[model samples]
Target: MNHKRSLVRRTAAVAAAGAAALVLAACGGNGDSSAGHDGHTSKSPSASASASQGQHNAADVAFAKGMIPHHRQAVEMADLAPSRAESAEVKKLAEDIKKAQDPEIKTLSGWLTSWGEEVPTEGAMDHSAHGADGGMMTPEEMDQLKNSSGKAFDTAFMEMMIKHHEGAVAMAKTEQADGAYAPAKKMAGAIITSQTAEITQMNKLLGKN
Candidate 1:
């Protein structure tokens, strides 16, 4: 009977040792990099929620969302003169427009970031709100401008850009009146100032044409 009891105790000890070994093997024995009990990678739920959260109030969001397409058309007009223009003045104006507004686009982009809102990267905006502001040029207009050269190009650029500028000014006025955030409001004022000066220069050139 004592021999039988000793044999049973030995079997139980071996079973326990085997179970522990199996557990250890599962914890990265075969060069698996993940080794901890909490090995699955996941962001904290709170952090993910905050990532998508928008910081701006509705008014601010509307301004940024509205302004993106407005800026893009300005860039398009600025870009047209280099290939098609004969005049140094037209080319210089295009370069100036590119330099001035490209940074403003970045500035507005930073505004979106600080506001925790997505910048309207897609060039789709409801054009009904533009109100005599040629925020986004028609496909027909683009096609017409594309086919043009020299004097015609300058004419198309000036006409399109002046309308575009008017649109931007309207948006800026709305932002100033409605936006509470100081940085955004300041940007609106700056846009009005800089673009107004550029508009005057553009008008002067147009008079020559």
Candidate 2:
């Protein structure tokens, strides 16, 4: 009877050991599964953001580079209206143009910097170098605008601004069609809407509408 009892106790001990080993294996498997789940969750947003930030293409680059200088030129023209322009309406328009384009120029520059592209020099393309490419005024035309005052200044400003806004609208359309970056495309859309309105307003002011 004593030997039989001892054998039973030994069998119980062996069974308990096997059960403990199985429990440990299950816990380890659950821990691994939980870790895998957490890793997948963490990586999903990172991958999405990486894709978004890396999505820009050549059209986006061109949009930024070209628009920066284009905007700068507009701002330059706008700056002259404060002391030089006679019409309150033209002055107000100039103020609005400056307000709109200044921030945009900064944004474009920031994008170029992030993309490892060289930002065009500020005030570099002040003349008509880009006249054929965009509706940029020639040095002589800018001088003529600068030299005029009162109603003459207003007329020249509106006419030149109409042309400039048209050029910007064209560029923005191209960007909307070709740009891969979401923010840039959105900006392009806004440009189209706002600049188109401004062009219409200028034409009306010039009695050309």
Cα lDDT tens digits for candidate 1, 1-209: 99999999999889989988898887646456654423533445546545654234566667777776677667777787899987888898888878877787787777777767788765665677566563567878888888999898988887777777778888889888987666667778988997787778878888843
Please list all clashing residue pairs in model 1, or write none if there are none. none
Score candidate 2 by TM-score against the native. Answer: 0.74
Tens-place lDDT digits, model 2, residues 43-135 = 988798667775889999988888888898889899889888888999999999999999999999999998889899976664343346477
Per-candidate alpha-carbon RMSD to the true structure: 9.1, 9.6
Task: Quote the lDDT for 38 in model 2.
Answer: 80
Candidate 2 runs further than 4 Å off: 1-48, 51-54, 126-133
Q: How does each model score on TM-score?
A: 0.67, 0.74
Q: Worst ten-residue run, lDDT, model 2?
A: 124-133
